[model samples]
Target: MKPFWIYYQKEMLEASRTYKWIWVPAVFLLLGIMQPVSTYYLPEILTMSGEVPPEAAALFTIPSADSVMASTLSQFSTIGLLVLVLAGMNTVAGERATGTAELVLTRTVSTLPMMGAKWAAMMTLMLVSFALGLAGAAYYTHQLIGPLEWGAVASGGLLYAVWLAWIVTLVLPLGAVLRGPAAAFISLGTAAALSLLSGLLPSRFQWSPGRLSSMAAEWMLGAGAGAWAPVIAALLIMLLSIIAAAGLLRRSPLSPQS
Candidate 1:
């Protein structure tokens, strides 16, 4: 077996033992429950806000209750992708910051394997969290909102997760490049900025991961056909990001103090 495989197993075991591991799935499950429930009730809440004058009410075409729920899920997922950044930001930088990298290096561990192990562990955690969240959301939405076109929702959600994962993959390089949690902070800033900037690009270039981050939730809310291009692009980017992150880790300077 490869050393990185062993290292990956160790990292996962450590993460599982930690208390915070429970929160990742728990919070996502809460979002799943809240999103649909809130969507169903939002119209009533708005109506209770007090009857607008006839003229104002006439101009406002209230969206359907189902649309409201979809919008809530979409919005939540957009912000929630940041959870990836938070989960990964310290994947590597924390080890270096605490001088653990030196200890790991002392064991005859190659740089590539160490980095590879960390990346694998982080990606595994990410994939599991995303799957759990999507499963919960899909189940609750189906139960509460009546029958949905799950094929559309599943494809959209999976694609969006892929895009977000690519965006998160940058955190590994950032963590390797910077010390401490600064990498995570930079990853957050980069994801947010890229999401905003994609809007300015031409539609031809819009299928990139950056655009996916901004519009994924909208697609989940039923943007219709042709959105699959970006979805496919996002998956491609996820693969590319992992390769790029590994290469970057391999090239980072070794600690002289070690």
Candidate 2:
């Protein structure tokens, strides 16, 4: 247990030191900032470009600050999964490819603990990035319009974050199962396929994790608690995937070096 924390701490420190780490938060925040800014000013931007007719422009106007805020939250809520896919794609696979994973596993740490440490770090990074992005988007939304339902906005943000975490569970295991570019490409391709399938599936299948990316914002606007069902279900599935991956990983032998 103590060793797990040590490894977890090391991974966190390494993550903080990497410049590439900046891209995760920056990209998420940029999308977050863009959401509200675009929602608030889209009409004006379109008008400047003469894209909307005077008669049509009247219909396109924002009704209230809440809807604009909702629209902003919705925009990034769906798109934010890409952040998880990109960041998590290389997590375990990169380590395995470079022989670092073998080095770590050779220590007293068990396979479960080693995987847990990485999973914990990945989970923390994902949540923190999403939260910061949400706060930034909220502030921008408030500035563009007036005060918003902060409670609703915050809840929506959290729902989206959880949804993203669930998606990461799926990707992280694939990262652990495959190595290097093969793992990353496979995870990314799977993400795209799942997204496409989710879109075409029936409403009952909407409970799937893939749909959470699209449904989170709606969860906020409607019954905030209702979304928890799918979110929790997805989390459970993610945990199961991790457990299964760990079992597979524990049985596999590390590649021998001549």
Say which candidate scores most in TM-score: 2
- Per-residue lDDT tens digits for candidate 1, residues 90-199, read 66766666667666766753566666676677677766766676677667667766766776666666656666666677776676668646777777677667666677
Q: TM-score for each prediction?
A: 0.78, 0.84
- Residues 101-213 of candidate 2: C-alpha lDDT, one tens digit per residue: 66666665357776677778888888877787777777887888678777777776777777667667665567666754565566556656665787887465656666665
Instruction: Estimate candidate 1's alpha-carbon lDDT, on a 0 to 1 scale.
Output: 0.63
Local distance difference test, per candidate? 0.63, 0.68
Write down the lDDT that model 2 would get: 0.68
Q: How many clashing pairs does model 2 include?
A: 0
Error of 1 at 233 (Å): 6.1
Q: Which pairs in model 1 have colliding backbones?
A: none
